[model samples]
Target: MEINMFFLVLLILIPTFVLIIQNKRPKSNLPPTPPSLPIIGHLHLLKEPLHKTLHNMSHNFGPVMLLRFGVRKVVVLTSPSAVEECFTKTNDVVVANRPQLMQAKHLNYNYTTMGAAPYGTLWHALRRVAATELLSATRLDTTTNLREHEVKLMCRQIYNDSSHKVNFKSWFRDLTNNITTMAIIGKRYYGDEINMGDLKEAVEFREMMEEFFIVMHTETLGDFIPVIRWIGFDGVEKKMIDLI
Candidate 1:
């Protein structure tokens, strides 16, 4: 059949094209790469507690190695000297830009927020504002009493509820939020004394934050597996947009 002939020709041409392109690339002074498999490239070698794996690789290979995880290329450095060099004044400025991540695109206001943003005029301006107006040493010092007050309230709740199971993580997160809100706007959204309107807002805020972190931590398949992604597997994309 014609379809069989077409399939035969396609399979034969694809590898030939790949080989031709590989032969055309100029040689580079790249660092040694570990044995990697096609399409997954070193991903199969990764294990739980990723820092340990990187450490073992660096220990055997060298302090620095270029690695590819799925489709992303990463430079792993274990040497203190190499780290110092990378973050030195000149190199620091050169590499100050943040990488554009798929999750950040939705969660970080299109990478416009303070931490996710690329280094440029906008980032510099935001840094200046934070340094002068929000995170200055004087500003933090002025809020010491407020932070202590919030901590005492948290401790009081724990002390009163010592008989039952306690969600320490929730309590600590609320305590931190209360301190931040109190410092910025002189308001606390959590606690038994808050009105129903404020309580609703607090619940919504907590839900939003929980979903944000959950989605942010989970790796999207589209990010790693291009063929599946290109074929319109967009479940992660839809979930993120719906959550947003």
Candidate 2:
């Protein structure tokens, strides 16, 4: 009888203690957020064209608002003044680090590249190296001849196309592709080789570029939900692994 009574008293006391502690805990002093559901939070509230949805929400919720995406806390900032404050006044605090993107996690030399790296000594060193070695005045001067040659070829192609009523979009893409190829690999594969058809290499290159852009633009739920990242639900992690 005594044991049973003690057990009942313990259960009651535990819950009372828990409630007191929870009540004592300080609430976040952050800005208000829209109503959020449990577990998934505001995941289902998002609409097509995410930027438009965010803009509409900002209109109702004010320029600065907090949001819970999955288990992640997000701060949404709108209005030019708020943006100026973030970028100008609090630049170091606001933009101190880059998020770990799926591609960066796998393909970027363990996120060591300047574009993907967290802002610090390593990223600063990499940026300095790229600026000095790849983007120096001498490097640009060396590539000027290549650029001029590609531009002249583009002009010739345009002249030829004037009589044929060709597609301007295709012509422009081809011209840009030629310039990029020359800049990167020091070879212009514009027209054709002995085996390849006219501009077939450029066409293949453009197709590859389109595929890369599509992959990069895709949204992955794992980005918001830390738990789902381990499961690789969206295959973004797998894709990055394969690319690497």
Candidate 3:
């Protein structure tokens, strides 16, 4: 009974001692942060419509606020001027690297894609190739005829369907998809031009794209908290691997 009481006291006192030490630690250089709970940090403070909540928090904490999303420390900049300064010519290079998310690692070829790559020689090469080969003035000029053809096709479709109710949203979406696909791959998959063989492939591609967006927006707890991922508590890593 005495040992049991001692253990209970130790358990209570240990966490209290740690909290006291943490509170006393120096943080003179860091931005203002709201009081956060242990383990979860500021996660409990967030609500639906996350952007609005953050904007509201800025009112009390100032434009530049430090927050912890689970175990990850995030510096929120609410003011446009503050954001612009953070991304200026001199600061852009320093902040070019993005957070290494789990989805990015598995789905983005181990972060080798231009958008996911860490700022380095590989990123520079990717940017150069995109500028010189994919998005050059000459490459854009070559797509002028393709854009006109797609627009004319869309107009004809609208005219043909004038007798019936037209879904402009869907038509515009298709037009945009067709234009982009034709520009990139010389094949358009979203319109009447698609054949039976291509139709199956196109359907699969569309489904894949929908799934990709769903995965991208998914809020996995493992992403912000390392132990959750290490213990496979969320199964997020498995889903990402399966997506790939």
Candidate 4:
């Protein structure tokens, strides 16, 4: 009975001590932040339609606010003047790079791909190449007919349906995938690419695309709470690595 009481007291004391340590603020001339809970910081304050939640915070905590999501510190700006000032030539290097995420390691060829690469010489070169050759205005103009054909196919599919109810998101994604595939490579997964004999392959490709977006968009706890990664509790990150 005595041992049980001691254990209960220890459990209660440990959490209180941790919370007290986590809530300690440092001295800095920084923007104001909302009162955050220990460990999770301000994560609980977030809600759907994230933009509206952020705007509401701006009304309460001024235009520029410093927020913490688990261990990650974020600086949010609602005012146009603050945004413009931060993005000026002097602060270009500070805010130019994208945040490193689990998806970047898998889908982005271990962060070397143009979409996820850090803002540096490689990224600059990739943007220049894309602008000049791959995604140039001339290239897009030439593919206008191909894009139209994909849209027509989507329209025809919808028209053939007896009831208008359908997964509009899937149809839109298929249309987008068709355009991107046909533009970069002269091949497609839908429409002209598949016949009755290859229907299985087409179905497989569609399922794969769906799964890709599902995994990519899903949240990773390690992203916000860095310790989850160091302690090897990153199952989501592992799944992403295995996927690619």
Question: Clash number for every model?
Answer: 0, 0, 0, 0
CA lDDT of 121 in candidate 3?
98
- The worst-scoring run of ten residues by lDDT in candidate 2 lies at 189-198
- Residue-wise lDDT of candidate 1 within 1-244, one digit each (tens)? 9978976886577556645765699989887789765556688888989999899998778998988766677788899999999999879987688767778888888988888889988898888998998889998899999999999989998989889999999899889888877887787877654667678877886678778888988777577656445555667767788888
Cα TM-score per model = 0.79, 0.75, 0.82, 0.76
Model 4 regions more than 4 Å off: 1-26, 141-145, 151-172, 184-186, 191-193, 230-234
- Candidate 2, residue 146: Cα displacement in angstroms equals 0.6
lDDT agreement with native, every candidate: 0.80, 0.73, 0.86, 0.81
Q: Which stretches of candidate 1 lie over 4 Å from their true place?
A: 1-20, 137-148, 163-170, 182-193, 232-234
Q: What is the lDDT of residue 218 in candidate 2?
A: 69
| Model 2: lDDT of residue 196 | 51
Clashes, model 4: 0
lDDT of 3 by residue, 1-244 (tens): 9978976886587557658877898867999999997656799999989999999999999999999887688999999999999899989887789888888888889999998999999999999999999899999899999999999999999999999999999899999999898887777788676878788889887788778878877878888866578779888788778877
Ten contiguous residues minimizing lDDT sum, candidate 4: 186-195
Q: What lDDT does model 2 reach?
A: 0.73
Give the winner by TM-score: 3
For each candidate, C-alpha RMSD in Å?
3.9, 8.3, 4.8, 4.8
